[model samples]
Target: MIPKHTVDRLSNRLTHLKPILSFEIVFIAVFVTLVFFTGGAAAQAPVGGGGGNTSGWETILDNLYNVLYITLQYAGLTILVLGFIVWLSARNNSQRSETGMKLTMGGAAMVVAYFGLGALVSLLEFIAG
Candidate 1:
């Protein structure tokens, strides 16, 4: 049962330290989570012309990239298709049409960029070789 005056005084003292205290708390939490969860038990990266297993950093990164591409492909397609439905249902309204157009264009751009980038990388490799 602390006194109200004492509690008020403590609160006032802590007012100026709130930001730093919050930052330190968040930093510690993230550091602990990353170090314990993801940073531990990680394998070595493939480099320096070493003959080794395929479970190195390159494979890990490629898998991550593939995951990213699949997510983007599905998400973009869903948005674009839903936007078309919404826009078509509200065809008399220009606002809805514009929204649908935006979605379609964005999805098209994502699909194009995905394929374009893959092609560009292959082209560069071919040119280099």
Candidate 2:
């Protein structure tokens, strides 16, 4: 077993780290928001090209892509925070650990699926064109 002094020291370290953690969180939030807004603006803008005008389907796809991108991006951030919280809690039981793992895996799966679907759609469009 660990000594009480060691535990106390660890607790003190964690307390000291709180401010750094808060700043990291705030920075992440701001960066994600900026990226989302910039990407959204580009997606919303009409694609100016020699393609002789963008088709309705193309416009729809662009909008859908932007929406999906933003949604997935935010969802990912939320999942990460939740997973971190669960991990920080450090449940003694195996069951809780399994639950946290599942949550993280689910979040990862969502990101992969979002990109996969987008790639598939782009491929199909390319082939059709």
Per-prediction TM-score: 0.53, 0.45
Give residue 58's lDDT in candidate 1 (0 to 100): 67
lDDT of 2 by residue, 32-72 (tens): 99898778654554556646565856777888788988898
In terms of TM-score, how similar is model 2 to the real structure? 0.45
| Model 2 residue 21 lDDT score | 63
Which residue pairs in candidate 2 collide? none
User: What's the lDDT for all of these models?
Assistant: 0.78, 0.77
Q: Where is the poorest 10-residue window by lDDT in model 2? A: 41-50
Highest lDDT among the candidates is held by which one?
1
Q: Can you tell me which runs of candidate 1 are displaced by over 4 Å?
A: 1-39, 43-55, 124-129
Error of 2 at 30 (Å): 26
